[model samples]
Target: MQGFFHGYAMNGIDAKNRVSVPSGYREVIEARSHARIIVLAPHEREPCLIGYDQAYSARLYEKLDRRFGDDFGPERDDAARRQFGATEQLGYDDNGRIVLSPMIKELGELDRLAFFIAAGDTFEIWNPNVLLEVKGASDPRLARIVRAQIEAKGGKA
Candidate 1:
């Protein structure tokens, strides 16, 4: 609970585009916000969906304010407006699932399945095929970094 997202999970998308949030991630979100709501947005530079709980979203808002300042200029206003406009506050259903909007699904190229990749402060939802391609083509340095991290943690690479 103290750390950021740190694992991966895959869940099926039903005909209605509903996918269950991974149970581990649900625990983290519930512990942080005591609610089953998450803010989701298409990644600005990736073919995936990014998600954050309420607390993290607030932190991001603060960061944005600091970066953009509290001025009334068009530049600042447009940046904030565009970012906010692209995000959606999605509430989980009784089954701990959320329905992905058509736009989100299309943006990620999500079809029958979603691959959840844990990022530091946010998680990403990806199309399984795209994730496979990305992993297959990832830089060799990334593999070295992962091996180093595992070795540092006393695990064999």
Candidate 2:
């Protein structure tokens, strides 16, 4: 079984927009023989970035087709086509780094700093201070809710 994304806090978006996938986190996914990742602009209110392992992305595509079908009405279809369907495809270089497109960088407001958060099966690229502020403001009740779910599912807290 693949290890759950335990979460990590990254400090910066290195020069060349290279975001390092920590060796610890890399070990978990690499163990599952997945080296490819898909980077998509998330549809969140804050315009965050979402990443998925190849396997997970394939599954998501399958689910979308099943639910939405091939026929997306013109207007809605165009928007979906423009947003999710046409998002960038990135491949890691030999050094296990991928360049974040300007569009993605701008969407996440990642100038010199960013955070790569392990979200399990997928990850998120967030603005560091923004994420910190959001986490700081989150209710403790929500934390308990997360803890309960993780524990109930036999996941490490």
Candidate 3:
């Protein structure tokens, strides 16, 4: 709870494009903020979506501020356009699900099923098949890394 996201879950996206947040993840978000909201943005280099809790989003903003400063320079402008401009704030419904926008689904190549992969400060929403391919289904090293990360976060291995 005090560290990063540390598990994976496969969820179904309904026709309305809504998917339930993993229970553990929902608990983490609820613990951090009163608003049941998640911030999602297209991964900078990957064909997936990156998600962050409100607390982590503030941290991201702080980092961006430090890097860009208050200047109207090109770096600041580009960063703003890429990061802030692309971010989406999604509120959980009564069912603890978030509606994925068409743009988000398209960018991430999401179909009916999505695989949520937990990273340290954030998590990723990926198309199931794409995730398997990208992570290499036969690679034991990836599993080891994920186990290590979960353990480091004080989660069950």
Candidate 4:
């Protein structure tokens, strides 16, 4: 999984809403996509953001095409529009930090910290508290990870 996202990290978001992308994810982004860029989009059914390399974004587009063959209906149009419109290409700086825009921040309600969990080709950026409210209790394993990270950051577990 050298070139795949497979870990978790939490980083402090600065006053300017910039946070360093975890080093491991940076490595995977470049290795798999040939660029130090991240494609970010609001998660379809979550109050979080989905981040991945450009390559994966292309793959997702192709997947949509395959899934909607010969169907030029409003449903397909809406799906493509939402998926593509929300996606943003962000370039990390020398220190591997990207500035989250107001819209991006609003999408996840991100504040002090950025919580990340890698899921294969994509990683999720979440407001830890929201994640807990949405997923924690129902997902014991994930709850443990999120709780430990929160407590490690001086937040109540």
Score each candidate by Cα lDDT: 0.77, 0.61, 0.79, 0.90
TM-score of each: 0.81, 0.68, 0.83, 0.92
Model 4, residue 26: distance off in Å is 0.8
Candidate number with greatest TM-score: 4
* Number of backbone-clashing residue pairs for each candidate, in the order shown: 0, 0, 0, 0
Which tens-of-lDDT digit does each residue in 1-157 have in candidate 3?
3656878876778899999988777777777766689988999988899988888877877888898677869978888788778788899977889998998889888987777888877889887556556774576666565555445544444
**Model 3: number of backbone collisions:** 0
The digit string of per-residue lDDT tens for model 1 on 1-157 reads 3557778766778998899998888878888878899888888888788998988877877878898776768887787776677888889987889998898789778887777878877899877566555663575654454445445544444
Error of 4 at 152 (Å): 1.8
Evaluate model 4: give its lDDT. Answer: 0.90
Those runs of model 2 whose alpha carbons end farther than 4 Å from true positions after fitting are 1-3, 28-33, 70-72, 75-79, 139-157
1-157, model 2: which lDDT tens digit per residue?
A: 5665666545446778876655555566566547655455664555467765555555666766776786777865665565467366676665666688787778777766556667777677766545545563575653454445445544433
lDDT winner between 1 and 2, please give it.
Answer: 1
Superposition error at 4 for model 2 (Å): 3.4
